[model samples]
Target: MSATRVQVVPNGPVLVSGPVRIEMPDGDVVESDRFMVAICTCRRSDDYPLCDTSHRRCRNVSAAPERLGDRIEREAR
Candidate 1:
């Protein structure tokens, strides 16, 4: 069996290698059998633990602006 991987996207959802099963606080279970899954960390997802990409719609870009510039290499280019 291959190991599962989890990647954290800056200001975005966490990427998980599936198939995955998640148990919620209310004893509800969420499962995904896809090759990959996006789990929300920003708590803005309408789907709760599952990301709905709602972070994209957020008006405040509160994360480090310098980090954003670093990622895009604004000066290098």
Candidate 2:
């Protein structure tokens, strides 16, 4: 009866636990009581919205924190 626990895993899927409703862009709604679901954020996942662990191959959100800092430093310099 409560809102689902949506956890955004770093460099990974959107970890969803507990009861919740998922609505697709095509106006389709998926309702389920199954907990521990991982929604793909890499976009490169062949499973579309599901995470098949393909994120290991296509790292869409993989970015080194130090690299970003270096870029900032270079730009400031």
Candidate 3:
């Protein structure tokens, strides 16, 4: 066994070198066999305690146009 290294990413998950066991608040344990793992800090992952790349922000440009139209219509009335 070697020392585990943790790296903090800017606006992203915590990168960890593994063979790590994570104990959940509900008394469940998650074990990883991989050499590395990503721990989610944003709490938006469908895979809890793991990074599924769900922390990335996505914008719907189509919806923005519709919202702008609605605002203009409301102001006219």
Candidate 4:
């Protein structure tokens, strides 16, 4: 089997190679056979783990790119 590719999009969803199966925290399972999948990272998707382009609705837009350390610190709270 080959390794799956995952690409992180700034302030958006992660793009992943598909034909994947996801096991949710509540034990529900979701599967996708698409060639590629957009996995939600912003937690704004009504689909939960899947991206629905909801991050585009973000009201706070910053000209500066956020540092990884700052993001980690903020999310830790």
* Candidate closest to the true structure, highest TM-score: 1
Provide TM-scores for the models: 0.72, 0.59, 0.68, 0.70
Please tell me which model should have the higher TM-score, number 1 or number 2.
1
Q: Estimate, for each residue in 13-52, the C-alpha lDDT of model 3 and write its tens digit.
A: 7788977799999999988989999987667789979888
Question: Could you give candidate 1's per-residue lDDT for residues 1-77 as a string of tens digits?
Answer: 98998766777777889799989999999999999999886788889898998889985745653365456565558
Q: What is the lDDT of residue 15 in candidate 2?
A: 76
User: Candidate 2 on 1-77: residue-level lDDT in tens?
Assistant: 66766656667777788755778899987665667787776676786576788878764555443454456567768
- By TM-score, the candidates rank as 1, 4, 3, 2
Q: Can you write out model 4's per-residue Cα lDDT over 1-77, one digit (the tens) per residue?
A: 77888666666766879687889999999889998998876677899798898889994644222354356457769
Local error of candidate 2 at residue 24 (angstroms): 1.6
| Candidate 2 vs. true structure, TM-score | 0.59
Backbone collisions counted per model:
0, 0, 0, 0
TM-score of 4: 0.70
The RMSD (Cα, Å) of candidate 3 is 14.1
- The segments of candidate 3 whose C-alpha lies over 4 angstroms from its true place after superposition are 58-77
How high is the lDDT of residue 30 in model 1? 97
